[model samples]
Target: MSKIQAKDVNGVRVLILNRPEKRNAIDLEMYTQLTEYLIQGNSDNDIRAFMIQGQADCFTAGNDLTDFLKHTDIDPQHPAFRFLFTLLDITKPIVAAVAGAAVGIGTTLLLHCDLVYADKSAKFQLPFVHLALVPEAASSLLLAQTVGPKKAAELLLLGDSFDAETANKLNLINDILPSDSLFDFALDQATKLASLPPQALQASRRLMRGNIDGIRLQMHAELEEFSTRLKSDEAKTRFHAFLNKKSHKPT
Candidate 1:
């Protein structure tokens, strides 16, 4: 089953994260479906614009860790890595609607999106340090490129979380709206994008970020080192502690 659901709002295609029960954590299957659509959406003439959002309160709780053990790899050959390529390569206007917790990849992924609307209650983080992994999805470069090295280091190295308001002030997110209105507002904005001169919109986007290209191999190299760290005694201890902490938390 696909963790992503698809629908067309006029000529704009909407892709929503469907695993709300798990707080929209990305499993391997979701990655495949998401990447497939990102690649497919751009090439399809019917799709004039695209939007991505979560199913419920949370944007994504990041990758599903237990599920990631067998399939996760930083190698560009890995399908997961290919998924990042699709996201970064999408030339069309991409919008994001973030609710509740936007963890790890959830936060990094927004760096590539064109316009981001977050719920006032939204929380964001890139907690790779806590997991003993380096940021993947070429986020190490992208985050620093967008937010400057000091701020990026503060988030990625410290594994800290931030609120949507703070994210907007920092220009990390475009706007923070009420949770109830987020998806509708994003769709409305998407409709506006769909009504624009498609070629000019695409051309403008390309012009701004055209110089940034080819981070797949770099991500692969970084993750090889990251996976090695994941297997280390230090990371093993931290991972177990996190699991233990979660186990004791109230559900």
Candidate 2:
């Protein structure tokens, strides 16, 4: 079975991350599939909105680093980069149902979403600082814009995980629901979005995404720079230490 499952619910196209055992950590194959799905979904008139969720107790543990180190090319045109760019450009409203660990890209991706419904256990982080790398997904810019520079610096530079309540206080989430009911709540919201005026909805979404072509170009450049730094001695040291500490932590 594919790591990313695409399904159409009413007019909401749902993308569910499938690697429960791995906390839905994204690898190259999953990223490629996600890119294809997003591209196809945009051209599907029947789809009015997009919804993303995860299986089990986690949204994602972030990228599968070892698989990434092995298969990821240094180019900015990687599948992961393509997928992130596609997501940022999508005009349709995106709603995310986040539960459990939303680490790294898991959390940054939500910054692009129009609405987010998080489970009480949800935790978010941008660990690039600790890894001696910079942010991907244009999050360095988007996040600071969303929550202001000081908060963004605290999250990005410190790379510490914060809980759902703190996230809600910062207006990062629409609501925090029990894990069991998160999907239902998000689907309820998506159904409402599906019923709204399409042209108006698209227009509003576009406004929020402002200057996307330009932002997408910037993100590509940012990812290229980040990819180069990912192989640096400092990055390798920090990354390996992270992996070692992570490996010993009982999940």
What TM-score, computed on C-alpha atoms, does each candidate reach?
A: 0.92, 0.94
Each candidate's root-mean-square deviation in Å? 1.9, 1.6
Give residue 165's error in model 2 in angstroms. Answer: 1.0
lDDT of 2 by residue, 78-136 (tens): 77787887888787889999988999999889988999999888989889878788898
Q: Please give the lDDT score at residue 192 for candidate 1.
A: 92
| lDDT, residue 138, candidate 2 | 87
Off by over 4 Å in 2: 246-251
RMSD of 1: 1.9
Displacement of residue 227 (Cα, Å) in model 1 is: 3.5
Candidate 1 least-lDDT 10 residues: 68-77
**lDDT of each model, Cα atoms only?**
0.82, 0.86
